[model samples]
Target: MHCYFHLVHTHERILDETGIEVSDLEAAHYQALKAIQELKQEGEVDDVDWHGWQLEVVDEAGRVLLSIPLDAAQH
Candidate 1:
C-alpha cells in the first residue's frame, strides 16, 4: 500500500512529505518512525521547535489514520 507520512512540526504550517510503499498499517507505522529517526540523525529536525511534532500517517485519500507523537529531535 502507498501512504504519505507527514512530519508536522509545532512552529511550522508546511508539512514535510514522505511517500512510501508498505504492506500494512504496521509497516506504515515503522516507516514513519524510521523516517523520523533518519531526519534526527541527519540533524534535519534540529532547527525547529518540535516538542509537539507528530508523524502523521495518511492513507491514499489523505485521511489521517494514525499519528505518532514526537519530542524534540535534539536537546
Candidate 2:
C-alpha cells in the first residue's frame, strides 16, 4: 500500500507528492516515526522551526491513518 505523509498546521499544508509504499498500516506508522526522527535531525542541523505542525499519514483515498505532533519529535 502507498501512503502519503503530509505536514500540516492550522493554515498551511506541505504535501508529500511522492508517497511511499508499505506492507501495511503498521509499517506506515513506523515510516511516519522514522520521518519524524529524520525531521528532528535535519532541524538540529539547520536550525529549522517545526513548532505548531503535525505529521499526518494518509492513504490514497485520503483517509488519515495517523497524526503526530511535530513537537513530539523534540528530545
Candidate 3:
C-alpha cells in the first residue's frame, strides 16, 4: 500500500505529493513515527516550532489511516 504523510495543524497542511510504499497499515504507522522523529530532530537543530503539528497518514483516495501528534516523537 502507498501512504502519504501530510503535516497538518488545524486547517493548514503540507501535502505529500509522492508517497511511500508499505506492506500494511502497521508499516505505515512505523514510518510515520520515524518521520516524526526525524522532523523533531530537524526542528530542534533548526529552531523550528512544531507544537501543534500532526502527521496524517492517508491513502490514495485521501482517506486518513492514522493521525500522529508530532510531540509523540518525544517519547
Task: Name the candidate that leads on TM-score.
Answer: 2
TM-score of predicted structure 1? 0.75
Model 1: lDDT equals 0.76
Worst 10-residue stretch by lDDT in candidate 2? 39-48
Number of clashes recorded per candidate: 0, 0, 0
Candidate order (lDDT): 2, 3, 1
Model 2 local distance difference test score: 0.87
Worst 10 residues of 1 by lDDT: 9-18
Q: TM-scores, in order shown?
A: 0.75, 0.87, 0.85
Better of 1 and 3 by lDDT: 3
The 10 consecutive residues of candidate 3 with the worst lDDT sum are 42-51
Question: Residue 73 deviation, candidate 3, in Å?
Answer: 2.5
In Å, residue 66's CA in model 3 sits off its true spot by 0.3
List ranges where model 1 is wrong by over 4 Å. Answer: 9-13, 16-18, 72-75
Residue 8, candidate 1: Cα error in Å is 2.0
Q: What is the TM-score ranking, best to worst?
A: 2, 3, 1
| Candidate 2 per-residue lDDT over residues 1-75, each given as its tens digit | 999999999999999999999999899999999998886676651475668888999999999999988876775
Candidate 2 wrongly placed segments (more than 4 Å) = 44-46
